[model samples]
Target: MQAQIENTAGKRLWIKLSAVAVVVALAVGGYMSMSNTHAAPDVSFTNLKGEQVSLKSMRGKVVMVNFWATSCTTCVAEMPQMVQTYNAYKDKGLDYVAVAMSYDQPNYVVNFVQTRSLPFQVTLDTQSKLADAFGDVRLTPTTFVIDKQGNIIKRYVGEPKFAELHALLDKALAT
Candidate 1:
């Protein structure tokens, strides 16, 4: 009855794997749902151009606020993709702001922006007040995707999957 024992063992292993998959799915669902309820803070960004861009004024646009530091490897690695994403969607009502952390030198931020020829607005949070307002964002590459109605719909703590992020932006902008 060796074959019978093997069949039973395989079935038991399959059932265990299926249960683990279900648990993982539920956890991800809960995490995603948790991000949909918070309203975006009424913050203003003064870009390197010395222009004021406010969240309230951008109520009808899908805004991406990226908090990044020049020294963060992950942040540096994701810059090209972020630029691509912004260029691809900027005309489709996507407003992107790259915010330099308070610790990042303004000169370095300016050099990075200039060297990269970044198309989106880049701002500096020199006093960290903007960081404090946006949920005390202390991480180097925290990103918040705010929906058209000024609600923080998605928060990515590290590098986001660009494809998934684009899909979410599509859905948010369609409305």
Candidate 2:
């Protein structure tokens, strides 16, 4: 009878340890997912005028790095709102950089910008390196709002509502 009780107690202890291990594993996984979701990588590329630009160089200003493609309707749709926002805040230390991905010829981007009258600086990502640098840019109109300290404060992956985008910009500018 004593041996039977000892065996039962050991089984109970094993079950408790297994439950604790499962909880620990779940906790670790949750933390990892949360961290990965927030941590976006820094990217660097040249502007349309052949000026080298990087997240590190815009440390003192709130930078909006927008990834776009000339063929994307949603990307083109957001240009006017972005232009308005940039024009309003440019004097207040808000910098906008639009990186055009998957466009081989700069003329395509230049033509699009000219047709739309986009005033913000535009860049061409010939190799899609900028998109790859900032995690998987699965969508055309991905925007990253970087704080003055160069940390990515917010990320939008689609045609952003102007109000929502402006709210994020205001928050970043306030910081």
Candidate 3:
């Protein structure tokens, strides 16, 4: 009955592994749920023009802090809509900061902006400090819409939703 004993031992090992996996999954889910409810971190970084920008400076305006990369297709696709949103609300003190995570050099970002004709303040996260500060962003095109009081109103980790973004801005403006 050696074979029978070995089979039973293997089943027991499998069951133990499954239990550990479930426990880990539950812990991770709980951590993420709690983290999502908190306000985003406040961090400062430099724009392509060498201007130091922080969340504090944009305090009285609805700010869109977008994390993107030159190689990300989804980030490129959202540029036009971002431009539209900026144009529509810039007069009302809306600010858009496109923080490039991949290409840190100013020339690279400047060229990208020039080629795309993107109308917004393009910045560089040289060491990805801002990205790390906000969250461990593992994907491109992550965005955070901060309200006038510097609170993170909403966050999107993928392609931007213009309607949701506009709604947040509208609410911030109304207040």
Best by lDDT: 1
**lDDT, candidate 3, residue 93?**
82
Q: Rank the candidates by lDDT, best first.
A: 1, 3, 2
Give the alpha-carbon lDDT of every model.
0.94, 0.82, 0.83
lDDT of 2 by residue, 1-175 (tens): 9999999999999999999999999999998866553434666777777788777777889888898887888887778888889999898889988888876367888898888888788888788788888885758889988888877777888977888878887887887
lDDT digits (tens) for residues 11-95 of candidate 1: 9999999999999999999987875468999998799999988889989999999999999999999999999999999999999
- Ordered from best to worst TM-score, the candidate numbers read 1, 2, 3
Worst 10 residues of 3 by lDDT: 33-42
How far out, in Å, is residue 40 in model 2? 5.6
Q: What is the alpha-carbon RMSD of candidate 3 to the true structure?
A: 7.3
Q: Give the TM-score of candidate 3.
A: 0.74
Collision count for each candidate, in order = 0, 0, 0
Better of 1 and 2 by lDDT: 1
- For all predicted structures, in order, the TM-scores are 0.80, 0.78, 0.74
What's the lDDT of the predicted structure labeled candidate 3? 0.83
